[model samples]
Structure formats: C-alpha cells, structure tokens
Target chain A: MKESLVIQANNLSKKYRLGTIGMTSLREDLSRWWTRSKNGIPKHGFDQAGIDPTRMINDHEFWALHDLNFEITRGEVVGLIGANGSGKSTLLKILSRITEPSEGKVKVKGKVASLLEVGTGFHPELTGRENVFVNGAILGMTRREVDKKFDEIVDFAGVADFIDTPIKRYSSGMTVRLGFAVAAHLEPDILIVDEVLAVGDLRFQNRCINQMKSIAESGKTVLFVSHQMATVENLCKSAFLLNMGQIIYSGKTSDVIKKYREDMEESANLPISQRMIREGSGKCKLSGIEFRNDQNKVVDSLISGKSATIKLFFDIYEEITAPMSLSLGISNSTHVRIAHLCMKTFGKWILPTSQKSFQVNLSLSKLELNQGKYYVTSFLDDESGQIIDWVTDAFVINVLQSDFYGTGMVPPTSQSIFLMDHSFSF
Target chain B: MQKQSITVLKPSAGWTGFDFAGIWQYRDLLYLLVRRDFLAQYKQTILGPAWFVLQPLFLTVVFTLIFGKFAQIPTEGLPPLLFYNSGLIIWSYFSHCFTGNASVFTANAGIYQKVYYPRLINPLANCVSGLLGFSVQALFFVGYFCVYKIFIPTASHFEMTSAMLTIPLLIPLVASLGLGMGLWMSVLTAKYRDFNQITGFLAQALMYATPIIYPLSEVPEQYRFWASLNPMASVVESFRFALLGKGSFSFHLLCYSTIVAVLLLLSGIYFFKRTERRVVDYL
Candidate 1:
C-alpha cells in the first residue's frame, strides 16, 4: 500500500441471489448439487439474449455491486450518494467487513470503524453508563481508552443526569445522542458513517458535523453515505454517485450532486403513462402534471415563496360511480413528506363523471418550500377509501430561494424543509 | 503514531480458519458482554441474583422429592440433598453454557449485522458468564454439603475423596461440551430456524441421558456404554464422585469423555466460523 493511500478497491463486486437472502431451502440446494454431480457443473445459459455470462453466477444471481472501483487517500472525506438499492449500503458493508465482497477485494491500511447505525449494539436493559462502555468496545475502543473518555462521552451526550438510568427509559433523542457520542469519540484511522447525522436537533446535527470535520482534519479518511445532497456538498471534497451497483460519477461533490439531481429529474420527466411503478385498481391513471407560474407561463422549476398552480391531468379508464379526491404530497429529497395538499381538506371533491380525460388545476398562493429537490406523490381515491391511482415520485420540483419577505434574506435549506409565515415581537 | 494495522477483506476465509488472535484482541468486548449478561439477567426481578442460587436449590428439592423419596432411585447410599444438589449445580453450569450459546447468533443479530468483531466473542462470553452463575450455585452446594455433614452424621459415604481433585479438570470439560454443542446448534439454527425448536428442549432431554438425577451405576450395564458415550454422562458422574465420593468414576470414562468433548468443540468451532461469515445476510 502507498503511504498516503487509505483505501483501495479494484473491481470489487457483490452478487446476491434474487429471491434467497443468504441460503436457500435444502431441497433446492440438493437438486442443484445433484444436477451438477450428474453433469460436472452446468455451463452458463448461453441462449438468453443480452445477458452477460460474467455477471451471472446462475439464474438467480443479481450483481448488487458490479465491478466497482474507487480509491481514497488519507485525510479525504468521500461521500457515497445513491438512490435506494443502488448498492451504497452494500459497498459500505463490504468496506466495514460486515459482509464480504462477492468478487475482487478492498485493501485498507488503517483501522476502519463503521457507524452503520448509531446504536448498533445498545441494550435496552443496560444503563446509559453501562451501554457507553459496551458501545465503545463494540466500536473498537479498548477498556482503558473508554475509561479515559467516559466522562467526556457522557458530557457530550448530555445524559449525565440519566447516566444510571436504563436505556429503555431514555427518550429517543437522548438515546440517539448517547449512541452518537460513543461512536463519535472512536479514534480510528478511517471512519465509515451512514446517515446518522440525519437524527437529533439542529444544534446536535451541527455538533456532529463539526465532530466529523475534526475526524477528517486529523488525517483520517472518512467515507460518508447519505441521501442528503446538501450535507454532502457542504462536507465532502469529493464524492462518488452510485447507480445500479456501478459508480456513475466520481468527482467534486457539487458536480456529483448536480448529476444526481439531473438523474432524478430525468426519471420524473418520463411520461406518466409509460412509467411502471404505480399502485391502484387502475380505474384511472395520471396522464400529465404541469407546474405554472402566476403569469400562466409553464415553469421548469417552482420558485420558493411564489404563487404557483399545478395542473394534473387524469385519464379515466372506467366511469366513476362515487366521489373522488386527489391528494398531492410534496416530500423532500430524502423522501420524508413535509407538505400535503388534499382536495378533501379544501372541501372540494370530484363528482362522478364519464369523461375520458380531464385536468384539475390546484393553486398554491405562496410556495413555502425551501430550496431543494422535492418529489410529488399523487393519490386518487374514492370516498370509500378505494384507491383509483397512486403514484410515488409522480413529479420532481426544484424549489429556488426567492425574496418572499422582500428583505432580501432567506435561510438556507438546511435550517428546515419548509418556511412558516409569522411575526415575532419579543 | 504507530503504523495502523492493515486489513484485507476477501470473499471468505477457509472453512477451518479460527481467529484465535482476533478473539483475543476483542477480549474487552467479551468481558463487557459477559458483564452485561450477568448484570442484566436478574434485573427487575424481586430476588435479583439470588435466583441464580435458588434456581438449582429449588430444582434439587423437587428432584429429591420426585426421584429420590417417591421413586426411590438409588443415589449410591448418599443423602438425597447432597447427591441431587451436587449434580444439579454442575449440570446447571453446563446447561447454562449450552442454552446461552445456542442462540448466540439469533440473540445478537442486531449487533452482529452492523459491526465486525470476532463472532466467537459472543459464545465465549456465554461460556464465561455461565461461570458466574455456576460459582454462586457452587457456594450454595457447599452450604448444603456442610448442612448435611452436621445433621446427617451417620452418612459417612458423603465424605470428600481424593477424587475431588479432578474438579479443576471437570469444569472445563463440561463447559467445552456445552459450548461445542451450543456452537453447533447456533450454526444450524442461524439459517434453518427449525433447529431452534430442537435446542429449546435439547438440554432438558440430554439431562436425563446424563446422570444428573441418578448415579451412573444405576444405568443398567447393557445401556451403560451408550449412556457413557453422551460425554456429559461421564462429566456429571465424575463431578458427583468427586464431591460426594459415592458416584462411579473411571479413568477410561473420563478420557473417553475428553476425546469426544474436544472433537465436538473443534468441529463446532469450524462450523460456527463457516456459518458466522454469512449468517448476517440471512438475519
């Protein structure tokens, strides 16, 4: 290994069986063995078109990580960003040695501690003080190290009052703080963190960010995985964007996040009728969705704190016999629903109609959403709670910061996902 | 600022690869886990740690009534309290080791899937923590033996023999047998889950096969060979013969039990290592 290189991977890959988790039923394994014994190992199924024989271990094999390669030097904080099931977790698991790669290997010249989750080994029955030592040991600290850091850890978590209390009696926030404190104090040469910073209040989150910064600055390599693009852009100097088990982009954080946003928008831009992921009886379907400004001009992205109208087009497959309602929910990039718009909440309902196609325009006087990527999920339901059509991530909207209060001051998106209208007279 | 240890991760290690040094490096974790088990076992209960002593004490009384007084099973002419308490405490230690370690994977799946350590640390902790509970019961056994000595003065057969020196050897033998079987059970149960049901009743079923309630001499000569093959049968008998100086013990039997125990332990570790690598994926 080079002196400065901390982590090096060459064509690392992980293959998983499609239906089976770890091991299949004994019957299936026995039959496969019997067949192999009779024919001395079956050849790859060559008749299938467009199937890479190298990628397919067998019929059930799904290559979760397909020849992924990356290198991180000491003192570099590299962010791993991807959509769900994009092999981000699989790659981290491989790096942390929680699971082994299916092919190839990764060599790391340092102690690597992975915080896959904050409280990976905390026992509810154990007191906060007891759990601290246990969690520290699990995170790879010696007893003497934990003993020296015990007071600091307790003070950082702010659980000194309840240090003797069982963790089961702790508030969720307190538990998260204690767990994070133990992990944050771990003195490893390389740290792998999953989205643990997403928890806690704003102040705690800032403290965690600072802690992570200190770790990175101490000449330790840090591999951070999160869907929070803003956090990635703020923290990491370089990042890797993974898609379908392959590194699609690896460069500066901003460019990678931009590429990731572009991919999301591209997927959302696909015509509604052509999309495959939807849940409903299919009596009606979403045809198109359009975002327009107050001037009636169609906009590519919605402006924060500006009047906007959303036009939803629906194609009815069967004649409606009951009242219907449309619920439009806007969620942040992390897929947490932050705002909801419902026809029923406004005392409006779609009466029974026989039209083949119709469009409803819902207007928002002022879009209070923060500046970030937001997804629109639409649900069309009848009065009896029967879903006619439900589509997750029906549309993607990029909210741009605007001077809503006319003071030319706007809070960054990190503060919160939505802006509230209020007056403070302290 | 010493050089950091480099770790190379491959797809899998050899099946028989045992990480003895790795397990040793994680000794603090093993200690903490053992402490956690010991401290957490009796919490929220009225009697607390006293249950560790009382559990075997109550079982001995029940066995003294059911098997000794009513059923009149031969105890080699020793007091029922001494015969039953000695066997129960020794067997309790083994059962604790077995049952505790048998669920090592399932019980710690939450932590096991997230972190990488010597997975052997869990079962090893189980074995070590079992000693704490065993020690308490051992003290209780000593108390009972002293009481019998004072009250039943005519029972000369209860005197300690030179065979009692074998205890230092017997404890590890029983513990290894339990740990070996438990490791095997953990591996099998990690995937299939059907083996879990078997492990639930296995200790109780194996207890009858061992001489926990009766002497090995009581086992008819025709079935004695088969019973001695249990590995634990000779261990419990030797334990009784050591303390009570009445139950039968032979050098050959102890050697046979050690051979079987060692084999089970080595093979158990082999399979345990093989399964632990991929066990998290299943969980």
Candidate 2:
C-alpha cells in the first residue's frame, strides 16, 4: 500500500524573543510591546530583528525558525539535522504543541509523542515504579495501558530489582534507563525525538536504537532531530538540514549529509592560527602541529593503513612540579570520537622539567582509519588531573581512500572507521 | 496508517478556547501531580503532614487571642473560634490555590518547557491537590468547634440547616475562583517573574479584603459596596453564613459571585491559553 501523508508542515515559523534583559521584568515586557507596536513589524515570519549576534543590540527579537515546510507520509523516518542553535529544538517544540508557531502551522495525524528530552516529567523523589506510571501518563498513556506494559518496561530498562527504589537513589544511568524504556514503549502514531537519545550507557543506547528501529518499522511517522550524522544516516531515509533557522536543504539522507559535511568543512577550514580556539590553563599552548608521512615528509594528509606520525608542537609558559601527559583525540566530522591515545597509558610521562618548548611525536605503524576528514584535539594534563592546556580541533587531517589489502573492497563512508581485514579460505 | 487524517496546531484564533476535554484526557497526569504535591510537600521535615494541621490550629489560636480578646472583633454574635475558623479554612484554601497557581509555570519550568500536556493541567492540579491540605486543616477546625461547643454552651447558638450543604459546594467554588485567578497570575508571573513575589503580598491583601478575620457586618454601609465587589468576598460571606448561621449573606451577592467566578475562570483560561505559547520563549 502506498503511504499517505501523515504529517505536513507548511510555512511553519517560530519567533523567539531574545536579549539579556529579555522576557523577564515588567520593563522588558512593556518595552517589547512598545517596540513591537511602534515598528509594526509582524513579529512572525522573516522579521528584520535578526541582526548579527555579535552586533546584537539588547531588547530585540529573533526568528528562531522561519518558513519551514515539509511533508511526511506514514511510516517515513525523517531526520532533522542542524548545527547548534539552529532552531531544531524550537521547531520540535512547535510541532509537539509545547509552543505554537508564531506564523503558519503544522498538520499532524493522530497522537504525536515528542521526546525532546527523555524523562522530562520524571520525579527524582518518586520511586521508579511510581515515576513509570506518572511518566507514562505524561506521555499520554492511560493507567490500564501502562499496566499492560509495566513489566516489559522494567525488563527493558533492566531495573526490575530496583523498580521500587526512589529515582533519586538510583544511579543516574538507571534513571535514564527507566526514562528511555517508558518513552520507547509509547505507542503514538507520530514520534518526534530530539537529541537526548545520545545519552545513557552505550549498551542502553544500542537497545534504544533497536527499539526505535522496531517502532519506525511498524509504520509510525517519525521525525528525528540529531546532530550525529551517523545515527541519522542509519535511521532516516530522508533528511532536512536546517541552518540559521531555515530549511536550506531537504533530500535523501546521503545528499543532505554530504551538504552538511561541506558546511562543517567550510567552518573548520579557517586559518590555523585563528583556529586554536581551545580552553585550558595558559600554562601551555599548542603552538603548531605537523603530520608526517612514513617517508619522513610533512604532509597535510596520510594514506589509510599507512605509517604516519602526528607531532604536536607546544610552548610551556611556566615550570610545573607535577607529572604531565600528552593525549590526542581523533574525531570525525560529526564530532564522534573515533579513537583516543594518551602517552600516560604506556607509563610515559613528562616529569617536572624546565624545558620551555616541547614536541611529542606519536607514531602510528598501521593507521586503520577509513577515508574521512578528522580533527585532532590535544591535551596536556598535570598529575593531579588538572588540564594544563587543551586545544579542541587543534588541527585537521584528511585520510585518503586506499586499498589497504590491495583488494578493491574499500569500506564505504557509512561505516568509515577502523575495520580490520581478514579472510578465510576453505 | 491511523483512522484520523490530520490535526492542525496553530496560534489559536479568537478568544482562546478552553480545552476542558484535553484536561479530561490528561486526568491521570493531573491525579499523579495532585498526589505528588500533597505527599512530596514535607519530605525533609520531621513534622511532615502534621504541619498542615498545626499551621491552622496555631493561626486559629493567635486570631482568637488578638482579634477575639484584644480587638474584641464582633463575629456577628457567633462564637469567635467557630466564626474565625470557618472563614480561615476557606481563606486558606483560596490563598493556597491562588499563590500556588501563580507560581505554577515558574516552579514547573523544568518539565513545562520539555513536555506537552494541557497547560491547564498544572493549575488544575494545584487547585485539586490544595484540597488535601485543606481537608487536614478542616478536620482540626471540626474538633476545635466540637470542643468550643461542649465547653462553652452559653456562648454558642449551634444549629444545623440545609444551608450547611453549601460547605461541600464551597470547595469547587473557592477552587475554581482561585484557580481562575491563579491561571491569570500563572502567565503574568512567567513573563515578569517578579510577580511570583508580588502574588504573595497580593494574597495577603486579598485575605484582608475577604472576611477572614472580621465579619462583613463591620465593613460599614458606605464601604460595603466596594468591599462586596471583590468576588471572593461573597464566597467567604456565603460560606460563613451557611455554616455559622450569622454573617452578612445576600442572595444577590451570591449570584454576583457565581457569575464573577464563571467569568474569571473562563477569562483566566482565555488569558492562560494566549500566554502559554508566548511565555515559553521567555521561560
């Protein structure tokens, strides 16, 4: 059977009032009324109040989302992707009826349950069993319905033994498990989930993913909001990329992801000197970084499964009596941690030394990473677990596609990290 | 996939429609909230729900000392203890619902911003849950009334009337009025935030405006019109009149208050729905 349109949002918009002294105080409220009336600008739609954030004048409104239009048929799993503060949350809030759109509207079929953040209505003081009932009610489940799914929810959360314990006494992981379990069992016709699913232990996340997959497969219309591209690619067939409160692109997940990557690369390809936006004590700074090929030549990129060295150049401003360790984290375009290596794991430490300048070269004999642009984040940590300096996105390195086994079986971008080669002949 | 085709959500048109049905749909949530508020109220305190009883008992004693003995305030020839206790219970119920409803949005900002249910559920829950606290305090008043009647037979003229039936009826009236006003303040407080503090002071002022301490007979004829204009003034007067059999009770004023309560409730809900969408950005 062909799918029918279950959700259609037309020219939907949500405007947010912003300013430091905004939305609070009677004075701000009066002034907002004043400015809104004097200007006679439709606060909805594309208002001219969206000045550059840096050049912001206090007491001005901004359209968080504007002129967004999309349609989803029954059983369609759609991904809504955006950079931070791209109005993803606002859009979901509007769709979920938590907030109304300042302009336009969204038409949805049947009941819609949105998990903008899982466990929203959970009470810490309430027992897990009590919260399960209360939280289920918040998600629009009847008491009898919750009763039917009660044991399954507890078993799914793996908290049956502690179901009667107060959620405050339960570990945060346990609270999150119960929360996610209840949310997963919500049998709504339309499901809208935000980025909160990225939390919880990895095993729990995997279980949630399986639950979401089963729910999506059962012909429920779903709209998923996430920044994690891999999760979106795995779950959504169609995707929308929101930038600056606008739906700039809407198409297949692959093409939208490609556009998103280009956007990330554009933002990240700033001059190296200016890209050292990091946070830590001023005791050390990553002055420069260099990537070297196996032939001892400095290069911007290295071939996959080939030998390379990552040299981090730093300047120590002050002498320290405590031990220090150098750590490197490699992350993908979606900011997923691909791998982490620290010299302290190998019992190597930089003792209290008066060396003003230092360089640590990490040699990789066989870099099994697949083709993708990766970011290097370097950290200098003191013995007492204080960060001397930590530079996030300190440098960018691109790994080139290559046939590591000399066979044409190169891993695709979907599963593009650390795949070992093996073969069995019978 | 489902039978229903579409439901369009937009900025509501005209006077915001009250979703009484929506509140009914979320009745279970409302029940849980009432339970949570009634129970979670005195978690850390050693004297837990007993304080609900003690607070009114202590207040009744103090009011008896100051108003009955010191000020010699006339309770329309009724026993001062019975008179003041009657007004105090009703006053406290209104104040609880009124002030608590005012802070509803701010207190539940954590959950309100993250979830979607009928926004009315919050205030409705507070109004309903406040009864639990009132019930405990009312029990104390009953016992105190019994003791006063048994101890001082000459000072009391206790007689039961069909009007006493209004006592049960008063709960929903006071609750609806307070909830209506609270709903109004809920949105105002959410936007201004400073109103959260002001509502407490407002409640105190309103208590004076109502006949909690003094009887309506003392308002003086010239000022009675202004005093009776307050919607709750009639609710308090009628309640005392129904129970104690002696206080200024006008049939027309009761009708006036009933009309005002209905209007306040509808308008309060109207304003609440309008502000619900607007305040989220600020919150």
Candidate 3:
C-alpha cells in the first residue's frame, strides 16, 4: 500500500480582486446581509461592475495564484522555489490558513506551524518567556507542550539570561533567535517556513537549517521556500518550481534548481531593449543598452572561454566629461554581485554629437563567467566630481559552459571571483 | 494498462469550526496576555493597581457632584455615592471591554500579520483583563458600602438580597455584549477606518444613552421605554440592583437584554470568525 499523505491539494487556486477595498457601502452591506440571511453563509463573490470613470485606473483583475496542485506525504521535506511574484507565498498562506483560496480545495491532516516571518505573535510589552507561550500557541502548539520544551527553547535561543525581560528590550538578533526557537520546538506535524532564515546571521541560519533537518528526520513534513538555491538543495529532497503563478516543475530538488538556472539563462538571453526593468528609484537609468558579437549581431548568450563583446550604449544626459568612468557587475540568483569591470583605464569613446548614443565593446579573450545567471551594471563617472550614470544590473546575459570547462557537470569553484583560466603543469 | 485508483479527500468545512481543544491547549497564552495587560498598564505608575480603585472613586465623586447634587437626579432612595459607584464600576468594565477589544486588530496588526492564532483569543484575553480591572474597582465600592452602612446608618438602610447573587451572573452577560460589539466594530474598522475615528465619540454618546450616572427612574416615564431598550442600561441597572437591592431589575427587561446580548455575541463571533482569517489582507 502507498504511504499516507499528510497534506493534499487539489486544483487549489487563489484569485484576488485587483483593487476593491472594503465591503461597506449600504447596498453592498445589504446584499451581504441578505445572502447570509438566506443561506447562513457569507457570500464570496466580487462585484463585476465597471470601474468608476472618474477614477484613474487601468487593469483590474490579476490572478496571484492560478491553478496549483501538489501533495506531501508524512516525513517528506519539500522546497518551494519561485520568482518574487510566483505565488509561493500565496500557497504557503493558503496552507497555513492565513488566507482563503478563491477556487479549489486543500486537505491537511495534522497540525501545521508556519513561520512566515520572524517574531510573529510576539508582543513588545510581554516578557520573552510570556511571548514564548503566546507565540507557541499561535503556531498551534499547546501550552503544556511549550512548557515541556521551554528550557530547550531558551537554551537554543541563548536568551536564558533575558527570558524574564520584556521583548521590547531584546536586540533584533535575540528576538529572531527566540522566535525561531519557539517555532522549532513547537512540534507541529507540518512546518512551513518562508524566507525567515534570511533575517539572522549565517550561524543562526545554519542552526535553523539543522533544526529543520532534524524535524524532517523525525517523520514530520516540511515546506521550505527561499531564493537561496544552495540552502534549498542542501535541505530539501523534493522541490517545486513556480513561475508566473504556476507550477513549472516538481521533482527532485537538484533537477528543479538546474531547471530554474536554465530558465534564468533563457530570460537573460533577451535583448537589452526588451529587458523588464522594474519601475522604481535607482542609482541611474540606461538610455540604450545592447549586447553584440564580433559580427555586430546582438547576442544574449556566450560560452565560457569564448570571445564576446558587451556594447554599452548610452547618451550623456549631463555634461562633465573628465575621465568619465564605467563599471560592469554580475550577480547570481541570490542577488550577490560577484564581479565588476571598470572603464577608467580603458581608452575613452567620445560621443559623435551632443545628446547622442555611444557604444563601448569590451573584447574578452575568454569569457570567464560560470554557468549561471549574470547581470551587468554599467557606470559612468567624471573625475573631480559627480558620478553621472551608475546603472547597476541594467541587463542580464548567460555565460554557458563549453566542453573544455569539463561537461558543465562540475559546480563553479569561485566563491567571489570568476576564474578566467585553469592550467596544469605536468 | 491498469489505471490506478487515487483516493482524494475533499477539504472539510468542519476544520473551520471553533477548535475548543486548541484553545484549551493554549491556556497559558491566555494567562500570559492577562498578566501582560495587568502589569503593562501600571508598570511605571506610583500607585500601580491602586489606580484601578482610584478611577472608579474619582468617577463616582464627579458623577455624584454633577448628577446627584447639581442635576438632582433621583437614585431610587439609594445613597448617591454607593449608587453612582456601582453603576460606574460596571459601566467602566463594559466600556473598557468595548474600546480594548475593538482596537484588537489595529493594535496588534504587527503580530496578526506575521502569525496565525485563534483570533478569538485576543478579545477573550482583553475581556478577562478588563474584568480584573473592574474587580479591583469593585472592591472600593464594597468598602464604600461597608463604611456607609456603619456611619450613615439612617441613609436608606443597606441590605443584601437574593438578587445580590446575580452580580456574578451579570458579569458574563456584560462581557459578552462588549466582546461581541467590539469584535463587530474591529472587523468593520479594519476596512472603513472611519469607525476608529468615530469609536471614542460613539462610546461617549453610548455612555449618556445608558444609565450609568443616574438611575433609570430619573428618566421621564415616557422615555423609560426607550431608556430600558438600551441593552447596557438594563445590564447596569441589573448589576446595581443585584448588589444594593435598590434599583429597577425587571425580569422582562432582563430577558430582552439577555436576548440582545446573546444575539450580538453570536453574530459577533460569526462575523469575527468570517473576517479574522482575511483581516490581515485588508490591514
């Protein structure tokens, strides 16, 4: 017989009305009352009336999570991987009963404890000991259970000396440690954590990961979501990759990470003009950006140890051309910028006309970037004063590996610097 | 090829029901919150818990001077100080419950957004903590009653009746009213926010509408019907009548107030339950 599943989701989907506020107008209130009076159930439908023409608005409906289905058996530790808006948090919220789904259903068999954020359910006025009970209760643990594990929690948090002190006085690190300890010791059947480990230092994070490993080993289910692929790969046996509110892949953790890397590469290969730059305040803006090969054809992907050209196309919006400089940086999925190249020493390429675009191509005898997603940052500066344009990560490009790099099977060895060459003297 | 039969379980609506077992399991949390509320309010104060008694005493003196001496409001032949103190104590409990519970969502938004718990625990804890405050004030009333009985022996001859037993009975009733109304208002305020602005004004208006400073007998006979219809009016009157045996306590009015309280409490719980899971989204 197949093992029993602790959590089951069938066609679970959540849709939120884009901009509707509260159900408070007299008419809406009356209709809600009528529906509840007639059926003894709160109505769950949205008003489809056209937007008020007086209001400045455009698109109305946006599905935060489309059709999603998955399952987890007892003792299974699963990782959820996705882009920022890919519905991972939404799924966790639904599973944790924080929000209701717009369609479909989910069945969870045992107690669930979710650490959506650190220090949740902690009252600043309450003592650390008091908050432990409150936080544990909020996470679905009994008071007696928390009491039984109180010492362990205090020990793990390393706040034994300050447990009697009000949490308002605790440092941010202490607060996070105590919060994680209470959650880890809560002993719920299923644990759901969402990027909470990102708050603490590396040591605490490692401790949390170890605790999660122990929890998983004890025949409990775990659902972990994070942008750190290494952590996900180390902690989870299975994984689900989500993109654009849909599950793109669900299988082995390593395979899903590999697939996500490939997807990133594919997106990075898009032309610079088509890059989707987020709308917000940044250091600088790119007037024009494009990547081209020696043949002058726009290219997005480059093989490792191969010649390639990066064209920095821009127009000088400000006038202060004194040793104007530029730098290019590359980063990985975790957003750790790993490399930087500057144009201060290189010969300057002057614009042909005022307010005109210029291109500067850097010829690499060999592309040293590893097989991963890398973004470029182009900076412009003038000596004795101002930094004109410092557009960082303006565009992304993929650096593929050739057979000489050894079948692309070996992970990149560089922690910070991308090695340009490797040779053996025999 | 043999097709495998998969057993799929449908999500049960029963999971949404009140998990009493869960609440019982988290009792320590309830006690911790009650302690926090009790201590935090008076942590740095000079008198500490003595402030609880002073609040009712101060209110009673002001009400006696205004409503008793100046307005000359009748107290059904009961001593003005005792009469006003009893009403003020009970009314304070209800008002505190209302205000504290109504602000539960807004006040704890930081925590609620980050965690999940039976939201009912919040209002329940507030009600219990407010009860402690009211109990402390009630002690002052008892002391005042005892001194009045000893020194002012001729002032309406104090006597405890079987009705006195009803004080404990009415405590839960009054609490239910406040919690229910507060839960309803808190849910509404999460979205409207105008309600938060108006809550203080509404609470003051409600105080005048209820017979806290004076007896129901002081109102005009024609308006007695309207005055008695205010659920809190009957609740306060019933509490004073139970303790002092000198105020109106009609069974019919009590039945009406009880029905209203039960209705409010059930509807409040229903509205709170329906909205608690989603209030964070709006907040």
TM-score of each prediction: 0.82, 0.78, 0.77
Measured by TM-score, the strongest candidate is 1
Report the candidate with higher DockQ, 1 versus 2: 1
Model 2: runs farther than 4 Å from truth? A1-3, A20-22, A27-59, A270-330, A333-335, A338-373, A376-426, B42-48
For candidate 3, lDDT tens digit of each residue in A299-368? 7777665667776665444343444556677676555667777665565533334444556667776677
Residue pairs in clash, model 2? none
Residue-level lDDT tens digits of model 1 in B1-283: 6887888887877774677888888899999999998888877988998898888888889999999989999888988888888888888888888888887888888888789888999888988888888888888788878887887788755777898888989999989888999999888778766667788688889999888788888888999889888888878888888888887888998899899889989999999988887777767
lDDT by residue (tens digit), candidate 2, B77-189? 88777888888888889988888889777787877788889888888888877898888877777787778778888876864456777778778888888988888898788
Give all candidates' CA lDDT scores. 0.85, 0.80, 0.74
TM-score of chain B of each: 0.96, 0.93, 0.92
Please state the error at residue A64 of candidate 3 in Å: 1.9
CAPRI verdict (incorrect, acceptable, medium, high) for model 1: medium
Give the range where candidate 1 chain B is weakest over 10 consecutive residues by summed lDDT: B188-197
Which stretches in model 1 have alpha-carbon errors above 4 Å? A21-58, A271-374, A377-394, A397-426
Error of 3 at B235 (Å): 1.7
Candidate 2, TM-score vs. the true structure? 0.78
User: For residue A34, what is the lDDT in candidate 1?
Assistant: 89
Off by over 4 Å in 3: A1-3, A23-59, A271-330, A333-373, A376-394, A397-426, B1-22
